[model samples]
Target: MSSQQSIRQQYGTVQANALKLDEEKAKQSVDALNTDLANAYVLYHQLRKHHWNVDGAEYDQLHDWFGDAAEDAETAADEMAERVAALGGVPVSGPAALESHATVDFEGEDVYDARTSLENDLETYGDVIEAVREHVTVAENLGDYATSEVLRDHLAELEADADDLRGFLADDTLVLESAMH
Candidate 1:
C-alpha cells in the first residue's frame, strides 16, 4: 500500500452520520466535545496533584476528598471522550494536545497547602462547569441531543463537587458560613 493508504489516523477521517443531521454541524459539535474532554483531563490532573500533595491540619481529610474529586474528574473525562467518538470525532489527548483544547490552565508547578488546593480545585471545577454549561446549548443547537445530555450531566456533577469543596473549605465549627444551605 502507498504511504497515504498505509497511514493510520483517528482524525480527519470521521464520517458523520448521514441521516441524523448536518455532518458539518455534527463535526463541529464533536470538536467542541473533544475540547471539553481535554479540559476534563487537565482538571483531573489538578485533582490528583492536589490530592497527593495536600498538607496541613486537614491533610488526611483533604487528601481523601480530593481523591474522590479526582475519580469524578476521571469519570467525566472518560464520558466526554466516549461522547466524542460516538459523534464520529477523535478525543483530543496527549499533554500538549489536551492543553491546546483545554478551557482552563492547570497548576502543576506550585506546591499547595490544603486551603490553596481546595481553592484551586474549586476554581477549576467552576471553569469546567462554566464551559460545560455553554456547550450544552451549543450541542443542542447543533441537533446533538446525546452530547447535550452528556454536557448537562457533567455540569451537574462538577457543580455539586464544587459546592462540596466550598462547603468543606468554608465550614467552620463556630461559623457555618454558607455550607449550612
Candidate 2:
C-alpha cells in the first residue's frame, strides 16, 4: 500500500481508539453544542421580533441594532450546527427540538416600546454571553481549542454589543454626570 493509505489507516485506528476511550467527552460536547444552538435560535427570533416591532424616538437605531444582533445569533447557530455535524453527530433542527434544548426564554408578546425591547435584548444578550463563556471554559478543558476559540470570539462580540446598547441607553445621563463633575 502507498504511504498515504498507510497514514490514513493509522489515523482511522487512532480515531477509533480515541472514540472508545473518550465517548463520554464527545457526548458532552454534542450536548453542549445542541443546547448552545437552541439558545442561539431563540435569541435570533427575539432579535428579529425586536427589529420588527421597535418604535420610538430611537426607532431607527434600535431597529438596526436588533438586526445586527439577529445576524450574529444566526451566524452562531450555523456555526454550532456545523460543529455538531463535524463531530459525527446530527444537528438538531425543527422548532420542537429547539424548544426542548433551549435554556433561554423567548418573549411571547411583541414589545412596542423601544426602550423595553432594548432592555430585553440587553438582558438576554448578557445571559447568553455568560453561558457561552462557561462553554468556552468547558471546551478548553476538553482540549477542543478550536471550539474554545470560536466561542471566545463569539462571546466577546456579544458582550461588546450589549455594552454598546447599554451605553447608548445611558448616554444622556452619563454626559450630564460628566459635565457636573
Candidate 3:
C-alpha cells in the first residue's frame, strides 16, 4: 500500500479503538453512577422518615438536620441520573435495581431513637463516600478527568457530611467513654 493509504488505515484503526474505549468508560461510569444514585434515593427516603418522626429534647434540631440531609441526597441523586443520561446511559429506576444497588439497609417499621437514626445515617453516608471514591478511581483510570473531578468533589462533600453527623452524635465525653468501654 502507498504511504498515504497506510496512514489512512492506521488513523481509522486508532479512531475505532478510541471510540471503543470511550464506550467502555461510559459503561463503567454508568454502572457506578446508577448504583450511587439508587443508594442516594434510599438514603433520602430514610432521612425524610427520620425528619418526620424524630422526637425528644433534640426533636427540633434533629428534624431540621435530617431534612437538610434528605434535600442534599435528593439533589445528589438527580445529578447522578443526569450524568448517566449525559453519558448515553439510562438511569436504573426500578425497585429491584434500587434494592440490589443500595449498600445500606434500614430496618424496622418504627422510627429509631435519635442516636440510632443518626448513626445509621452516618454509616450510609460513609458507604456513599467510599462508593464515589471508587468511581473516581475508575474515571481516573479511563482518563475521564471531568468525571473523576466531579466524583472527587461529591466524595469530599459526602465525607464531610458524614463526619459532621458523627460529631453531633458523639461528644468528646461520649467518645472517651466508648473508648474506655
Candidate 4:
C-alpha cells in the first residue's frame, strides 16, 4: 500500500480567514456548509441516476432536464466545499462522513417510472431548498454574509430546478399504462 497522506488541517479546527469573520462564529457556518455540501452530493447522485434511467414518452425532455439539474447539484456542492475551506474548516469528505452529515435521503437502487422519478426529485429538491434556507439564516445570524450570499444564489437556482421538475410532472403526455399483452 502507498503511504497515507498527512493531514494539513483537521476537521472542526477553525483558523483565521482573510474575510476577518470571527473564528468562533465561522465554525457554525462551516458546520452548516459541510452539511449542505453533503446534501448537495446526495442530490447530485440522485439526479444522475434519474438522468440515466429516465424513460417514457417524455424521455428526451426529462433526460435532458435531469442532466442539467445534476450539473447544478455538482456545481453547488463544489461551491459549498470551497466555502467551508474558506471558513478555515476542513470540508467533510468520504462516503461515510457525507452520508452521516447529509439530511437528505437517497432514492436507492430501484428504478421507477418517469413520473415517480420526477416526483422523487421534486421531494429531494424541496428538502434541499428548506435546509439551504435555514442555513442561510444561520450564516447571517453568525455574521457570515459571504456564505449567506452564496447559499442565497444557490437557493434561487435550486428553486428554479424544482419548478422545472414540477412542470415535467404537470405534463400529461407520458404513457403510464402498459399495452403489451
User: If scored against the real structure, what TM-score would every candidate get?
Assistant: 0.86, 0.80, 0.79, 0.92
Q: Cα RMSD (Å) between model 1 and the true structure?
A: 4.9
Judge candidate 4 against the unseen true structure and give its global Cα lDDT, from 0 to 1. 0.89
Candidate models: Cα lDDT each? 0.80, 0.74, 0.75, 0.89
Deviation from truth (RMSD, Å), model 3: 11.5
lDDT of 3 by residue, 1-181 (tens): 5566433332101122333447667777778888888888888888899998897666777789889988888888888877776665777777777888877675446778878888888888877787888888888888867667767766776887798797778755423545543
Q: Show where candidate 3 strays beyond 4 Å.
A: 1-21, 172-181
lDDT of 3 at 122: 86
lDDT of 4 at 29: 93
Using TM-score, give the best candidate's number: 4
lDDT (Cα, tens digit) per residue for candidate 1, span 1-181: 4666754446744566644767787788877788888888888888888887877556677789889888988898899888777666677877888898898999777887667778888888888888888889998888888889888888888989988988878756543457434
TM-score of 2: 0.80
User: What's the candidate order when arranged by decreasing lDDT?
Assistant: 4, 1, 3, 2
Where's the lowest-lDDT run of ten residues in candidate 4?
Answer: 172-181
Ranking by TM-score: 4, 1, 2, 3
Best model number under lDDT: 4
